[model samples]
Target chain A: MFTGLSAFPLTPIDEKGIDKRAFVGLVTRLADAGVDSIGALGSTGGYAYLSREQRAWAARTAVEAAGTTPVIVGIGALRTRDVLNLAADAQSAGAAAVLLAPMTYQPLTDDEVFGLYEAVTAEISVPLVVYDNPGTTHVTFSDELHGRIAVLPKIGSIKIPGIAVEEAPGRIAVLRAVIPAHVTIGVSGDWLAAGGLLGGADAWYSVLAGLFPETVLAITRAAQTGSSAAAVAASDRLEPLWALFQRYGSLRVVSAAAESLGLVNSPNLPLPLLGLDHAARRELEAALVVLGLN
Target chain B: MFTGLSAFPLTPIDEKGIDKRAFVGLVTRLADAGVDSIGALGSTGGYAYLSREQRAWAARTAVEAAGTTPVIVGIGALRTRDVLNLAADAQSAGAAAVLLAPMTYQPLTDDEVFGLYEAVTAEISVPLVVYDNPGTTHVTFSDELHGRIAVLPKIGSIKIPGIAVEEAPGRIAVLRAVIPAHVTIGVSGDWLAAGGLLGGADAWYSVLAGLFPETVLAITRAAQTGSSAAAVAASDRLEPLWALFQRYGSLRVVSAAAESLGLVNSPNLPLPLLGLDHAARRELEAALVVLGLN
Candidate 1:
């Protein structure tokens, strides 16, 4: 019965380390915007870059800001032990669920993939979501693979990126046909929000929710109430920002947007990823202003 | 100065976990092939797929088999702390140097990349090799960035993959000109051996060395002695297997070749990576036989 918009808030960091006050403020704003859930340590949150201590702090801040709302902690890492450690830390932070992606470096076998989930789920008491974002990680959870993973005892949901946006509905249908009714299917693309809703996605995962929470919430509300016209209108208004996300990729665009919104001090990405170019930054800033967010 | 051929030996896993006997045997065979050094836990050795305990055991086995020769341990991971821990373990296991790939997963900034190396080198006592393999890790070390990292204490070498074969000479030249003369540059990819040597690479990071150590040693010795005819003869003999490595990709081709030579019991890969198809297996087997390796 998970529905509506979920915000993936950026984990703020400065030279000294995790900026807890800034993180708490961002989460408070997200919750005030009517976000149904907050997903911390997601790619937009720079989960891969943060130290274990930073991840725990971000998860705690999200839960504290959420008050009664659920918090889903991202536990994606190359090592299963690290994932399990994060999962346990999330539980200690009172997160309602854990969102996990498979090991990023080595392409795992189907059995090893299953074992990864099984091992992680075995360590934590919280509900688990099999987060499938193959573009960043270079690994995909096929519909067949999803079917097999769905049967795990605590696997309550899936956060699938619409890599093939057009075929998302068919993919959703295939997943829905396999998973039990209790397990919710969530789509992770802004463009596919309308289609994901019409195709029976229970909720939408929005990176935009970090900077434009109210707008994302409004869209989800309209979609849930079956107000197709209102939903389309919201989607149209947000399409420009989504286009920006598509341009430089979500992780970079979302981080930049978060910085503009004053949710975080700087878009400090870890090693290997450069900051946005001047043109991309100006483009993002213009989009934010257009959306009345900057 | 580092020279000759290095073998990245596969870690053996059985029902009881890491098969020490199998691993020891594999390393012993590589030693018999007269490999200059033994590399443990690399992509070909399934390093990322291993648990920390398994990795430690593999390192220990490699050290034991290596005897007087050096054992280079792969210490790359998603988390900085884990990499540090692995480096410490590797040093204790008597590994002569640690091969560190910059943080995997998300793209990183140059500062953060430098921070990772600085942190590893600060705590670990052994020499470190900066491994730049963008194909697997999705990150590359630019010459400018390499120049910055090279200044760090204990950073004694670099291992650059030969996919960018043409670019090897320029990179090696830059490193040789900038870094200390003692810091050797090792080249990966069998086909790039001649080019790499001509480009001033000091050593061959040879996967083929796992199967044909003598061949690799002969080629390197010939190249060092300025015997072009002998070097070409060796390269021609091993060219088919190297071509197969390029076609099927290094990890798959190496594992398939090892299985064909009865070095590894199974051609099993961890989750997400499908094993070689029958046609690929046949081609690999034929290539190995052609090279007189099987």
Candidate 2:
């Protein structure tokens, strides 16, 4: 199930809470575009800023709206009990798999993190994807720790942060040799998806793909078919957008992009996290058009 | 209101929910021992690991148990709406002040952090303490950011993380110069409390003082009375315990210490945060005894 382009859509928020209408439309669009999987509620989905009930509804909605496309729901929370409840919610909602980042409040020890995975993996029925997004979750997983969690039963994939394009091959090889063959490696960081894909990552767990599925699918397909030049060209074409993602973070950049594209309501992000400012928003809108992503 | 030793006790939890009886006993002990204030749901209280209802209950219980002693309730949450709800709950519960750490899932910018304080400070009736806890919150506040937020209406204090004892004098002096005279500067990090107090800090925001009130009170009282030598000596006596705190985090070390001292039920911490292992427990018990903190 962990292959090709997996689109992680924004779980848009309005005054009421999860704007399910906007969320469903985003998921349905990804499925209709023929992306490999729908990753609902990754960091892009603002999973941490939600309540258990809200997260459960979003998980169920993503699975229902994705139709034939598999849905991988992000079920990360600060507490193990909460993560277990979320995992149960996602699995019962008919999610194809579950994504878990070792979300932290107090800094975690390697042992605590491993214990968290062990406890959850022991209870859940579906395959689990180990989400390693240090920028958001603030928990760094060492290669040895990754190797340990990767072998646990139901571990379907490991979504790793991007390495430099030049270092992707050797780095992925080093990681690939340590973990089990059955566990696929999905690369995140929209800007680094090409290097990760060409460097032999099995899937692209993407943020922009949620809004612009066709654009990323082109890169994924070219990489899958061994058209390195085509993949690089496609990725290079979106450099301007990637620059904005690097500058404002893909979540904020895409929240603005989605609003500008009329895919979601403005002020869509959960509060305490504002949307991009006027200049960044204008720049993003122009980039979307100049890159022909509109 | 934010001065002297503010004892931050654990809001102990059990199978059903908050162990209110245990929590009340801890708060009562702090109040009875003549602590200057009670910090209800600080990081040591596991504020990040609770629901709005649970936090509200904890806040009410602490204020009620603290009697006339001022109680500062921690009102940090990942969402601004939740923080506002928590701040309102704490205020209604008769809390004297609120502590807010800029909690994050997506790492926040300085502007966003400032915006959070601005938004919350506008609404809360009680004074607010800016909790600059990077270890748990993973969001660092620059001195410039602290200076900006300290001027916001209702800002009573800023609780800065500890620096080296040698650096404390100049560090506190620098910060003291920036913030308004009414806004007290409190220093956290149990090991550095002495240096902080002697270094011209207005208060010691302490974890150890929660469980061992008399122990840290001696140091606080010594510092308050201008007995720098006595304060240093008192802090020195607990050097072994501080060694454990530095080795394991103060929260974990204190959780283990609390359990050993029969302050609460075993496994007092929130889920996913296990208490110290057997060896650490054994070491902790020995340290408590040898240090005469038993």
Candidate 3:
């Protein structure tokens, strides 16, 4: 079952490939900070850029480091068979769940998208989280499709994109109406965490949580405890850091933030995704200092 | 020295993995049909979907099948080091050239893009083709960047998106002026091939050429011979097939067309990219008959 702040850490790659020591360090930090789960190979993990072998290695490393904590591995790819292959690997490596994103080169029809998840779910006994990150995957899920996939066997959760903070409550309510109560509804996109939690999202699938796990968990706890003002105050302070995420991607901002806080060895965002520019790094440092993260 | 109708073929994969027999069959067919060059592992080849090992295997198969015909292998990836590694494999496989597309998950700046090519060209002895496929790579080469990259040593050619048939001549002329005389300027997007040839593009980097080489060569030859009327007539007859390419992607339409003609086992558009729909297949059949390719 997926709940609470699940930390999605960046997979650090040095010259030797998938720096196991750096990865173990980050995952152990999050586990020790008391996050509910560790989501490895998420977009922040650079799943798309890595070779299948590298990804599997990263997953194993994260799971081993996570100890008693559940590890949810992102298992998205272009092919149904490949996704199935990854899911099998994830299940074998002791992952609690495999996240599916229906990532395709061309636009997929709803039926085709459903077929992908159906194929993967049938193969893996582990629970599935339908990751609806349309921004990267380019495959948007309709409410009808959501309701359809929600009832599939071993489907534990659905990580929906963050709605506007103002619309988070209504959006959560609408999804809850159709999706079965058993399916945990988590919110992604770090900026919308407090609003989504306040609006009754069961979990926050977080990027910042990888580095600042206790801080993120604190915010989630405040929202869950019905401390509205406390949650609002916490979310308000994170706005500046979130601005860096909006300017550059969350992947870039988070990598820089982690390095600034001495969580990761280097601010090396894997290739294609460059590290933050000098000015942006300065801005991130200021935000981190103000938030008492650095 | 890339020139004439260079065929870009799809890599066939089945349950057993990269269908080596099928790939060899397709590449041999293209070589027998007298294509000027073989562009193995290009976009239509589904470069992104394949593993490094599979890609190297495909390149080797294509080169051996191509025989004397120049084989250009696509060596694009998210990381500069990965591209370099692929380029080394392509070189070892006896490929005549390696095509580099600055394909990145994150948007790359002009400097970062240049740095990638510079890093690649420094390592390999073979010429590199700067692939500017904005549709997939999400990285566009400015005219300025194009002119800048043209002068790099061993940078033999640039595969540009095809312009409209009517605008081909002018576009080719403009590029030819900035790009050196020796660097071959090839036009991709098969629908724009005839016009690109007529407009004086050095070669047609064609998808249809993979399946129907002589037919495409005939059109290119006609244009080369200054028979504009003949080239136009040939392109006009294939408009219906071009319509399918415009509606779907060239990868899908070309794969469908190739399969319908019995050139390969099936029009198996790789995963993430589905095969043609029933209605589109019907429409393709009709077009093939009219063009005498069925």
Candidate 4:
């Protein structure tokens, strides 16, 4: 099930808490778009910024709104205990799988990271995706570590960060050689999604697909069908938006795009992470207009 | 009040939550040693792995145990709202000041980081200490950014990570030039505490001080009194222990030492953060005995 496009939607949270209405709309929209799966509460979902109650509600809500589309709920938290609790909540809420990242405050050791996966995988009933997002979690998984953890029960997928285009095949090959055959590889970082998918990644765990499902799905379908040129061309068409994502981070830039597109209320992000400034917002809007996304 | 030896004790916790008796004992020991201040809930205190309620209880317990000793509670959380709430709880619990690190899961921007300080400073009743431990927090503050935050009201201190012995003076000088005069600088990284203090830092935020206050206070005093050789000699005496800290992080090593000393129960750390392995613990015990710290 961890194949093709896994759209990661923003939770649309603010000072009051999860923007349930906007969130349901985002999820329902993804379900309608026929993406392979919905990854609610991933990095783009801002799981780290939310409370467990809020996150559980998000998991249930995303599952409900996604209809028949499989919803993979991200249950990453600073504590192993909280992650277990969240996994139970996600499973109870009828999630297809639970995405777990080794989130840290006091930088975790390799053994500690392994212990996290070991402890969680032991209790969780659902298939667990290993979220190797170093950009946010700061816990990088060496392939040796990945190999060790992959043999654990219920380990379904491995979500790797985007590798440079030229390095994607070799990186994916190295990772693939370690994990079990059934454990699919999902690539994140929307700008590099096309190359990663073409380079033999089984799925694209995407930020852009959350808001612009059809847009990224075009690239995904093209890549999956072996039309690499079309996939690259489709991705190239949104170069301007990707540039903005690169400059200001996909979360902030996507929030700006969502706000500008009037899909959600202004200041949609959680605090300390304000929406982009006026100049950056203008740049984002200009990019959207250039890409005909607006 | 922010100057001198600031001891950050481990918040002896396991699955059952904060060991109130052991925690109070640690706090009382620091107070009895006449350390300059008690930094409750700092990284060594495992504030990140704890719930806000647990942290509030820790703040109150530490304050009660410390008697007249001022307690600075760490109030870092992933969200600004949570950070604000933690700060309020800390202040209500009678914390002398709130220590905050830009604890990120989604890497924050310069503007967002500055905005975090701006929003937090405006709300907290207690003075705020900027915790700059990139080793734990993963958020590195620029001198320009430090200068920007220092100008804000209620900014009391900056806790910098340790530097190389030779580079300490130049590094401190560069940092001192950027921030305001009144905001004191406290140096962390126990092994480098002597160098940092001798380099003209106002305080030593020593992890060792949390467990063995007298051991570190001797070094701090010698450095503060301009006895450079004495301070270096005192630090040098603990070279074996420092080497262990360098090999396996200070937190794990210190926890092992604390448990070995019968100060806390074994496996005192939060889940996912296992105690040092048998070999590492043996190494730590050997080092402690060598330094006569056991």
Best by DockQ: 4
lDDT of 4 by residue, B98-181 (tens): 999998888888788999999999998789999998887788788999999999999999999989889999999999999889
Winner by TM-score between candidate 4 and candidate 2: 4
Runs with alpha carbons beyond 4 Å of true place in candidate 4: none
| Stretches > 4 Å off in candidate 3 | A106-111, A173-178, B107-109, B165-182
TM-score of each: 0.75, 0.98, 0.92, 0.99
User: Candidate 4 chain A — worst ten consecutive residues by lDDT sum?
Assistant: A11-20
Instruction: Give model 3's TM-score for chain A to 2 decimal places.
Output: 0.97
DockQ of 1: 0.27
lDDT of all the models against the reference? 0.77, 0.91, 0.84, 0.91
Give the per-residue lDDT of model 1 (tens digit) for B1-294.
256678877675543366677678878887777777888888777787677788888888798887877889998876676788899999999999888987466656676688788888899898998888776787767778888888889988888878454776677777678777777888887787766775678888877776567777888888878886778677877777777777767777776666776666673454434457799888877876766677
What DockQ class does candidate 4 belong to? high
Q: What ranges in model 1 sit over 4 Å off?
A: A51-57, A118-125, A163-168, A191-195, A267-283, B10-34, B38-41, B44-98, B108-130, B140-158, B162-185, B190-202, B208-212, B222-294
2 versus 3: better TM-score goes to? 2
Q: Which 10 consecutive residues of model 2 chain B have the lowest summed lDDT?
A: B11-20
lDDT of 4 by residue, A138-196 (tens): 88789999999999999999999987788899999999999899999999888898999
The best candidate by TM-score is 4
* lDDT computed for candidate 1: 0.77
Looking at model 2 chain A, which ten-residue stretch has the lowest summed lDDT?
A: A14-23
lDDT (tens digit, per residue) of candidate 3 on A82-188: 88788888888889998888876556778778877777777888899999997777677889999998988889999998888899989999989889999999999
TM-score of chain B of 2: 0.98
* Residue A90 in model 4: lDDT: 95
TM-score of chain B of each: 0.93, 0.98, 0.96, 0.98
